[model samples]
Target: MKFTNGYWMNRPEYDVESPMETYDARQDEKKLIAFAPFKRVLTRGDQLNLGATTMTFTSPVENVIGVKLEHFDSENHGPSFKVNNLDPDVAIQIDDNTASLTSGQLKVSLPLRTDFDLKFTVDGKLITESAQKAQGVIFNHDTKVSYMREQLSMGIDEKIYGLGERFGNFVKNGQSIDIWNQDCGTGSEQAYKNIPFYISSNGYGVFVDEPQRVSFEVGSENVDRVQFSTEGQSLQYYVIYGPTPKEVLHRYTQLTGAINLPPAWSFGLWLSTSFTTDYSESTVLKFIDGMKEHHIPLDVFHFDCFWQKGFEWCTLAWDKEMFPDPVGLLEKIHNRGVKVCVWLNPYIAQKSSLFVEAKEKGYLIKRQNGDVWQWDLWQAGNGFVDFTNPDAVAWYQSKLKELLNMGVDCFKTDFGERIPVDDVKFFDGSNPKQEHNYYTLQYNKAVYEAIKDVKGSEEAVVFARSATVGSQSYPVHWGGDCLSNYNSMRDSLRGGLSFLLSGFGFWSHDIGGFEDGADRPTPDLYKRWTQFGLLSSHSRYHGSNVYRVPWNFDEEAVANTKRFVDLKLSLMPYLYTQAAHSAHYGNPLMRPMFLEFSEDPNVFDNSTQYMFGSQLLVAPIFNESGRGHYYLPGGKWTSLLDGKVYSVPLAGQWVDEEYDELSLPVLVRENTILIRNEKADHASYDYTKDVDIHLYQLSDGKVTTKVVDLHGDDVATVTAKRKASKISVNTTGISGSVNVYVHSDNNITSARLVDGVAEIDL
Candidate 1:
């Protein structure tokens, strides 16, 4: 992807062609087309042997401009990201020397005669521009491949974020990232979910609109520019503009796809039978009973790969030997008010009974010679399900319908990152290279739709692993395989933060880590990770060779698990409301610190901490020393635990403290109204009744908080305002008496709801 030896010259083998000037401009409908040649037209003879690059401009939504650069026009194969074009009104102006297209507050203009940079601006202020020698039509003789590329200017101290679920440093400034999906674990440069989109600190984001592999050099190849290239005849990208970081995400999600709200019960704690562990009906019964005995709330119980027999993974059948009566077992678990999730992947092994049927029906991918593509990677001679074929999708879904009938609630759609591309052919003739990353999208979509069809749309959810640009529509995705050490836990947080910034609504990870090998986590690691996992949007305890039940570690671990699980269940009234907000406006439930505190430079690179929902700040303890480090941006924060106060006077102050294993930083923001139900035993209940509305440092302005029911509908809206020493509270859609607590620097005061309103004087 990097073509430059230095700033002055290109690498010897690559023949690069860049536009010198835009010679002509033409308007076709709403699109403005510009012709820029590789060389300047000094004479009529100079235009004889040169090739020209065509740049087309259009607008899809307000404040978003789409630019398509083409070296040579060719037929575009099927299967691209589903871009929602709402057809917003745009302004097109043509002058003698320049051509500009404006959509809402964002405009893209290019020079007509003398070549100038293709500039993007918001309200006439430059955000980023494609300078000279920035757009490339390159041919690498060594690889015999053609690529279309564009390099946009990066501002000073501009921090880049959201190149998908990356595991390294939070700020993606100097990484050479490839938008290729891989099965590598969480501690590598390769990512399971690779999105061809990045948000810049300069109030704009660029999304490459290609399903094929798009390689990006974020100030790596050229220190001053961020370059993205694809192996094709054309490259298409869109520049989304926003004055704030959240607004940029709002617009990007609007353009790509809206986030689907997972079921409310999914926000509760999920306990899974560890992968590769020996688990039968007895083992499952013991784990579920243990949770009940220990008084730890559980919502979903998942069965990993061993649910099916070995080497027959996607058979979608319950191993008869392991569970002779899967239906009865599932019913028993459901009777306990718990849901069931089973693991599945798209690869159909030859040993599976469905293999012959799939091959005969053309449900599996085939090679160019028309033979079914088979490999011996994870399973012995497995073939990928060709999701491009509709019958194949139905065939796969039919197998899952059996599971649904057996009381399985959802599926952990895993292992789509290992799809093969070489010499393979899709049923619908989709480009092979393009199908590599996009295969996960279709794979997850098929499973999600089946679940939606069987269990009502309100109950559909999937814990997917691999993802592409628009995979945010699939509700919940987890951080892939990770080690059991503290460093792996730290990097997993980084990866999840980056994934949330990529326009996802909810995310989760294994509690004690996935690839824990033989020696599982230490007792301290298990307890520490329990606190972090329970605080996430979706919580799951899963691992590889060892069980993840807290009692397996120690009694302290059991207590830690119960404590946080109880806290999370009590906070569902607040969490589900914020979750509904994310579904409505495409904001992530788990947010990177910079997304909330964009004005504070100290939070721009802090991945050790994050904002859970919209009100709480969580800083996970990563080291074994029990020392916690976090920053609060220019506000007064109150601990939801133990009634402690944190008044940070400095603009960016980091608080370092030591604590027992029971707690870490879980701070409530100032001027916020948080609703909680302390007596609620589960995640799904009537959120409107018997709830405590805690007003933390209520500012002078009116702040309204809305609560949603288990079905994700508005049940109540509580508004409070304070001026000086008096605070007035008003409520709508509330009938029963409510308790109100006022949290301040000195102490906490309590009051009761009188006639659906409350007045408190300090």
Candidate 2:
């Protein structure tokens, strides 16, 4: 993807043509067009053999401008992303030297003369511009291939983030990234989900509209420019403007799609059968009973790949040898208030009984020679299901419907990253390169729809692995395979935070890691990871070749796991509200510290600590000694574990705190109200009953907070105001009884019950 040898020269066998000047500028009702030639015209005779590139600028919606540069025009490739744009009317003004197009608060100016330069502004303030050699059409003369690339100027203090769930450094400066989905583990630069979208700290975002491979060089290929390119004759990108980073994400998600709200029960702890480990109905029951005996809360139990017989993955039939009575086992688990999730992939092996039928019905991906594509990787002679065909999607959904009829609650849709690209054909004739990353979107959608059809819309969820740009429409996705170590654990957090910035709302990772059974995770690592996992939006304990049962490590691990699980259940009232916000708006549950503290430069590269919700900040312990270094932005923060108070300075300071294995650093922001349910023993409970509202450092202002029930409906609203020594509380839309507590420095100074309205003395 890199074509330059240095700043002064290009690599061999490459010819890069940049727009030297704009020869002509014209305006229509909706767009502005400019013709830029690679070489400048000295006279009218010089235009005889010269070719020019057409540059078009238009606004798709308010505050969003789309730039398309083309050398050759062709029909748009099929299977484009589903984008709904609110195109408002725009006015184009042309003069002798400048041509300006204004839409809403955004204005784009282009030079009417020969010089090709573009300047973008919002509300009369400069945002960014494309100038100099920012736009180019490169040709590889050796292979006779060409590409189009565009670079946007970055501000001097700007930092770029969010290029999908990246495991590298948090700041993307000086990094070369490729948006190609792969099966690499969480420890590498390769990512399972590659989204061609990035937001800058300077309050603007850029999105490449290509579903195929898009390469980005963030201040690497060129120091002051963020370059993105695709292998085609045309390139299209959108510049979305926002005054803040949070607003940028809102606009970006509005352009794509927002995350769907997951069911309340899906927020609790999920225990999975370790991959490649031996597990039967008895083993699963023992694990469930062990959780109960240890006083650990359990919600969903997932059966990994071995649920189906070997070499017959995705058969949709239980392996009778391991699970003799699958129906009876599911009934028993359901009676214990647990939901069941089975693992499935889109690949069907030749040994599967349905393979012959799939091949006959053209439900599998085929080669150009009219034979079903076959390979031997995870399974023997596996063929991928073609989701492009409507019939194929129906056939696959029907298989999952049978499992639903037998009492399956959800599915873990995995392994969409290993799709074959070359010599294969889709049923709808989609480009193979684009389908490689987009296949997961269709695959997860089919399964998710099937679940919604069986279990209503509000109860549908899926644990997906691979994703592309629009795959955020799926409810929950987890970090893919990782090794059992401290480094892997830290990388997993980095990946998750990066994913949240890319517009994914819910994500999880293996509690004790997923690989390296010979050298299992240490007891300290398990205890530390347990704390972080249980606090995630969706928690799951899973591993490979080794059981993830808490007791398998040590008794202290069991106690630590139970403690955190209970703490999470206690915070359900607050967590579920945050989840609903993520679904309704585009805010993320797990946010990087900079998202909340945008003015503090210290948090720009800080990935170790994150804002759990709007009110709480969590710094996870990574080392064995339980010592962590985190920065607190200037605020009056109070510790949630103990009633300890810390007043941070205006410049923001770092604190290195030592914690026991039982706890980490969780701090509540000042002047915030957090709602909790103390009487709930499970994740899916009546959040309206016996609610406790904890008021933190009410500094003479009015603060209002609302709580939602199991169906995500508003059940209660509490408004509290402080006027010197007295706090007035009022409630409306109350579903059940509520109690209020006033805390100054994490101590409840006064308590009262809500009887229409109440007042407490501080």
Tens digits of per-residue lDDT for model 2, 638-681? 88888688888888789998999998988899998887776666
CA RMSD, predictions in order:
1.0, 1.5
Q: For residue 124, give model 1's deviation from the true position in Å.
A: 2.2
Report how far off residue 753 is in candidate 2 (Å): 1.4
Look at candidate 1 and give me any clashing residue pairs. none
Q: What would the TM-scores of all predictions be?
A: 0.99, 0.98
RMSD of 2: 1.5
Model 2 residue runs over 4 Å out of place are: 735-737
- Residue-level error in angstroms, candidate 2, position 176: 0.6
- Candidate with top TM-score is 1
Q: Worst lDDT window (10 residues) for model 2?
A: 749-758
